[model samples]
Target: MPSLLEVLKFLGAGVLGLTLGVEGLSWLYRRLKPAGSSRISEVLFFPCESHCMESLFSDGRVSGDQCVCGETHSTALQSSPVDPFYRMLSHLLSARVSLDICVFSFSNFELSRAVLQLHARGVRVRVITDRDYQTIQGSQIGVLRKAGICVRHELSRSVHMHHKFCIVDGRLLLSGSLNWTMTAVQSNQENVLVTDHADIVAPYLAQFRRLWEANDPARHTHSPGNADTYAPRHHGHVHKGHYADRVKGLVHRAEVEKHTASNGHVYQQ
Candidate 1:
């Protein structure tokens, strides 16, 4: 019933109203969304070295580094179905100085191969694991031992050395519910937290040292072919000095040693 000009004007106003309403709703939604909401898909499996390596204890408070201690970042494959094995491999491939690992179980060949490759490239690699799991059919401890990677097993047969953590280059720490196994990577529900916070890394490093020293290879006897006869191409012990320097500011040496001593009574298998 309206004239042509009036009809056109009415339609134009309706279109303009709809556009403005949509824009307003979008703005409100964005304003209400939580921080890091957009980063939900960026599962954190490794520290971004350039952005995360700065010490967090500067001025006695957490620094501006992207990877802050206690600010947990997680990686999982169960819901998304991504290849967690390769994701973990990518992290190991980034190690430059050292890799310290403590896990309850390990059998994934691809992950073990990545670790062997890292050792071959001159990274100092050490592993602490459960004795029972080490003897499993696909366990990689034998492969690691044959390659001269220092590996130790828990001395206590009753208690399992159930820890799933790895420290890379003394700066980044990876820990979570995930075990180093094919089932964990391929189908099991698992998660990994990666960070470069020195405080978090220090305790784990101390624990690893305790376990490593307790399960000293010199004190234990090995089968004829089990001894690591291959001397490293480089002076790998020098890397330990580098690690010491890295943690000096974050954790007191004496404090760590005391902590280690207090818990050192636990025998390794």
Candidate 2:
């Protein structure tokens, strides 16, 4: 029968062997890993409260005060731990030419700051958010608007502009279930997908353009609840097209119905 000391020795040996085996396997995997696999993309999760992303700047590389994203890095204000949302902000700050953002909520202060920084850097920024949320307490929409950023919100009361996406440079795309709010960033579970795949990005770019045109304050002049009357926003020049013709036809039909109803006659389309 083995003594107590022998039993302890056997257990210790087994643990050391297992650890060594794992280390060897990891080394081999790294050596054999395929190239370009790491370039695929990145999917970052949120709610990382313990380790804020400020750590990424711990080496004093980039700082906002200098007005740089990949422009420069700053030293850690907190600790050397990577936070995912802040990582996302870094990517957002890298925008060079344009950023078209469409989202439901816009109350996140850090995000607002990034957008403002981009704008100050001469990046063309367009923001489309929910009409209702634009007035909510702590909303950054008003701030963006006050800064002269082009902001167009949904005019529908029943439906909302719930898209959370931003196209960067007409190439890179950022979209996901994350909301630009502190609660969503610090507590709620969220995910952000960042990709620059052309095929995938092209569609989102088109969608943004469509929404931008559709929500143009000029386009909503004739819409219900809008105070401004319908008029061409661009120097009184309306784009002549099928949509223009359709809008005119609908307005005419509505007027005819109203007049007929007042006279007790049913108007036919």
Candidate 3:
């Protein structure tokens, strides 16, 4: 058995290491995400802003008509596809039994609004958000639970949970780079993999459970700081039956269209 002082020292060192590691990784990520011809995961559906909607909706060989996800096609404006993000939010709002969200931070207005709506609908919304930004994002926690959403903070060393994922009805999951923040939807280069596979969703569910259980008050603590001052900048193939191309075919698309450059490597724009 170790002395209490030794245990404390070890814990302190571990926390410091986690912080440094995250900062280092973030720097490297900034370097690699330049725009060029580097191939990425096949995009299925993504949000389009003002400029690309017109070009994207034009008829092409792969798609007989304009992409259905286009914002405008003819005289009348069209609706965007209900991508995974919207689908997940819709399901959450419609959930009668439960809604589980495990995100590093919970600050986006749209996302928070959806949670509140779900609460109003009598759905049990449980959230596990990062404690680092609790002071900043924490204000909404009380508001959510007051409306009936059950929210919890993950008591971990890292400033970020570093995982953006959600599971719904034990049947569907949305996981990947998209965080519950304004930039993720509006400007950042991010992608989320949505799936209906229980096997993949199981591990994430287990991780959330373990973290939630480990959140004992006496075990973790953080020093007070200006929490609101910082805005921390932060796949799969499935087979379907043959001959039923309508039900079996898959669509790939890009998530964000931002230019990035690195040591001669360019990514999608």
Top-lDDT candidate index = 2
Order candidates by TM-score, high to low: 2, 1, 3
Worst 10 residues of 3 by lDDT: 248-257
User: Could you give candidate 2's per-residue lDDT for residues 87-129 as a string of tens digits?
Assistant: 6777787789999999988887778988998899899999998
**Please, what are the lDDT tens digits per residue for candidate 3 over residues 1-269?**
99999999999999999999999997887566654322322232334232222222222122326456454332222244344445445444545676678886565665787777666767666787765444342235556756766666654333356677877765567777776765566566677776654446689888877876665443433224532122111112222322142122111101111212223322211
Worst lDDT run of 10 residues, candidate 2, spans 72-81
1-269 per-residue lDDT for model 1 (tens digits):
89999999999999999999999998887678664454222244322221121121121133444435453222222224244444455667679999999998887665687788889989999999975567655678899999999888775433678999998898778888777776666455667876665556789999999999876755544435534211111243323333344344224435544564687531111
Better of 1 and 2 by lDDT: 2
Per-model lDDT: 0.64, 0.71, 0.53
| lDDT, model 1 | 0.64
> Which stretches of candidate 3 lie above 4 Å from their native place?
1-85, 137-139, 216-269
Candidate 1, which segments miss by more than 4 Å at Cα? 1-83, 220-269
* TM-score of predicted structure 2: 0.61
TM-scores for every predicted model: 0.53, 0.61, 0.50
Regions more than 4 Å wrong, model 2: 1-40, 50-81, 222-269
In angstroms, give how far residue 123 of model 2 lies from its true place.
Answer: 0.3
lDDT of 2 at 200: 71
